[model samples]
Target: MWLKKIGGLVAILSLSFSGMAIAETTKDNFYLQVGSNRNGDPIVLDLASVKGTEYTLLEQHGNGIERRTLRAACIQGRLFSRRLAVYESNGHLTRVDKTEQEIFPKPRSADANSMEIVCRVAANRTK
Candidate 1:
């Protein structure tokens, strides 16, 4: 009876550990995929590690920008800033933004914490 109990405990532990896995996002950087299927079914992939600023395209849709590097702390396809849409590796609009880039001359030197982007309003319509 004791032998049987020990075996059962081992089996239970093994099964529990099998499903115990850390999410793709780690202590540093990562990736994710959020979009729809061919039939317009929503899907998501919390990816593994992502190294640099340049994103890696994982999958592409027929219309929207290709999903790429996982934005840490993003939810429901939006970033922490709650940006309306995402973009492609090649820098295509995620939806339709009517924003413009700030055209300020670069300072003598750059600060690690300061970054800038040029935003443009979306022209395409998808509802």
Candidate 2:
């Protein structure tokens, strides 16, 4: 059942991105939309900043934005935020966190989608 749900979500994401061009939708060419979360907030991955198993993810949250450095454990199929920066709506940096919290993304959540995308890319990079 869990596999089925993840597959269904992947299908939905594929369809959603099929009609849109990444360059036209994102603010810049370096950021690609991974997918939106349950709340419909856009989640984007910074393509140029990806290094090995780490990726930079930018997410829209309410009236603010968050930039996170996520380390994808491709083998374990999980990821954790190594660093985070919260920004105001005007693009002002409000807070920066350098904590090494290892919170796994919940199933079927936006973070799950991000983990799935990042892990897939990271896995492919090794091959």
Candidate 3:
């Protein structure tokens, strides 16, 4: 009977250690939907594809009809901004570039928009 109890305790310990390992390997994703732009077009941002210190930022508009992807690396780099700004023209994604600091001067505030939030979260995760 004591042998059975020992085996059970060993199993429980192994399971708990495995759970911690899984949690360490797992990556988190952040999703947010900001309000519409000047043309009343909705915008959405998803940061799900995280690998190490890098992640992919997926931006969608007009209910996913318009999509833009930005490969963001949160590691130490020369880039001033980690998040890429998606420029839309006439309800279409036209260009993507590193976001300007001036655009999100108060990024840490609770009222920050989706882009600022994603940028901050991604950078923090890298650290």
Best by lDDT: 2
List model 3 lDDT by residue over 57-76, tens digit each. 33333333333433333343
TM-score, every prediction? 0.21, 0.66, 0.32
lDDT of each: 0.27, 0.64, 0.35
Better of 1 and 2 by lDDT: 2
The residue ranges of model 2 lying beyond 4 angstroms of the native Cα positions read 1-28
Off by over 4 Å in 3: 1-30, 49-64, 72-115
Candidate 2 lDDT score at position 31: 53
lDDT for model 1 comes to 0.27
Candidate 1: clashing pairs of residues: 31-70, 32-70, 96-122, 97-121, 97-122, 98-121, 99-119, 99-121, 101-118
Once fitted onto the true fold, the runs of candidate 1 whose alpha carbons sit more than 4 angstroms away are: 1-29, 32-36, 39-42, 45-59, 63-82, 86-89, 94-127
Lowest-sum lDDT 10-residue window in model 3: 17-26
Q: In lDDT terms, how accurate is model 3?
A: 0.35
